[model samples]
Target chain A: MDMTFEIIGWLAGICTAVSFVPQSLKTFRTKNVAGLSALTYTVYNLGVLGWVVYGAYLKSYQMVVFNAVCFAFSFSVLAMILRYRRRSRL
Target chain B: MDMTFEIIGWLAGICTAVSFVPQSLKTFRTKNVAGLSALTYTVYNLGVLGWVVYGAYLKSYQMVVFNAVCFAFSFSVLAMILRYRRRSRL
Candidate 1:
């Protein structure tokens, strides 16, 4: 693979990995999650987990790092949604 | 790459790509997007577009196909958020 292509892949990975930050921050700030879906987050986390496994299988450092970071952020958001939803129900 | 690894990659890609369907369906059914973030979607679209470019550079058909599907679904959700926000503001 060309070095340039590798750089592009890294760039893409970074972008995708960090894409959840703004939303997570918003959710943290607002503590509002009426628009968020638990089912979506659950499935998304599973997908990210699959990517993590695939990354390990392929020995792709970029894939592993990117998806790992994404999984953490996504998991946090999912946790927040669960917390908020439970609180709201009470 | 091992064929098994390729299969895992495709599985991961499919999971990630189709992950948005449930959320999009929920939004469509409920017509509720109070929790969706326009900024997040915008950045996400950019990220997915970056992935598309990176996929093209790598000649990875799976990457290209997966991100293309993701981009379409993310865009529709963004559009819905915009529309709903505008209507709600009035």
Candidate 2:
């Protein structure tokens, strides 16, 4: 049971971590900001950052690592939105 | 110290939970998924579902609840993507 839960947790962490990959790629490739929400990514990145801090406090290495990974993906997405949105304006 | 961490956790949870709202709303209102990635939302939903299950095992109310909220938002976004993409094709 312990091992089972461990697998489940890791799977959950991996899923959460990798979930941003497709969006990041699509957004970067297409450079479309039409449907993406800047507010969502901004707040999401902040939350992910907070999770990294909280995880460190709790010493939950998985959370720290995965959320950090997630943060990178999301932060890049946010940056893309800002960049693309700016370019679109100009 | 404990209270501080607790507050941090809840704030993190709130951020994660509400982060999806803007995207969902924007997607629904604009009906523009061009910038969105179906694979990302699909995998993200699955990951969040996993979190709900893992949280249940740990009896973490916040995890279960926040993740459930996140799931709903992401799921709707996924559904909207399918719906709109189909409509777009037709």
The recovered share of true contacts, given per candidate in order, is: 0.59, 0.83
Candidate 2 lands at a TM-score of: 0.97
Query: TM-score of candidate 1 restricted to chain B?
Result: 0.89
lDDT digits (tens) for residues A1-90 of candidate 2? 978887888998999898999899988899998788999998889888889989999999989999999999989899999999999999
Best by TM-score: 2
Which residue runs does candidate 2 get wrong by more than 4 Å? none
Q: Write the per-residue lDDT of candidate 2 for residues B66-89, one digit (tens) a residue.
A: 999989998999999999999999
Fnat score for model 1: 0.59
lDDT of 1 by residue, A1-90 (tens): 588776777777887798788888888999888888788788788888888988898788788899999998888889999999999999
Q: State the C-alpha RMSD over the true interface residues for candidate 2, after superposing those residues.
A: 0.8
**How many Å off is the CA of B20 in candidate 2?**
0.6
Model 2: clashing residue pairs?
none
Worst 10 residues of 2 chain A by lDDT: A2-11
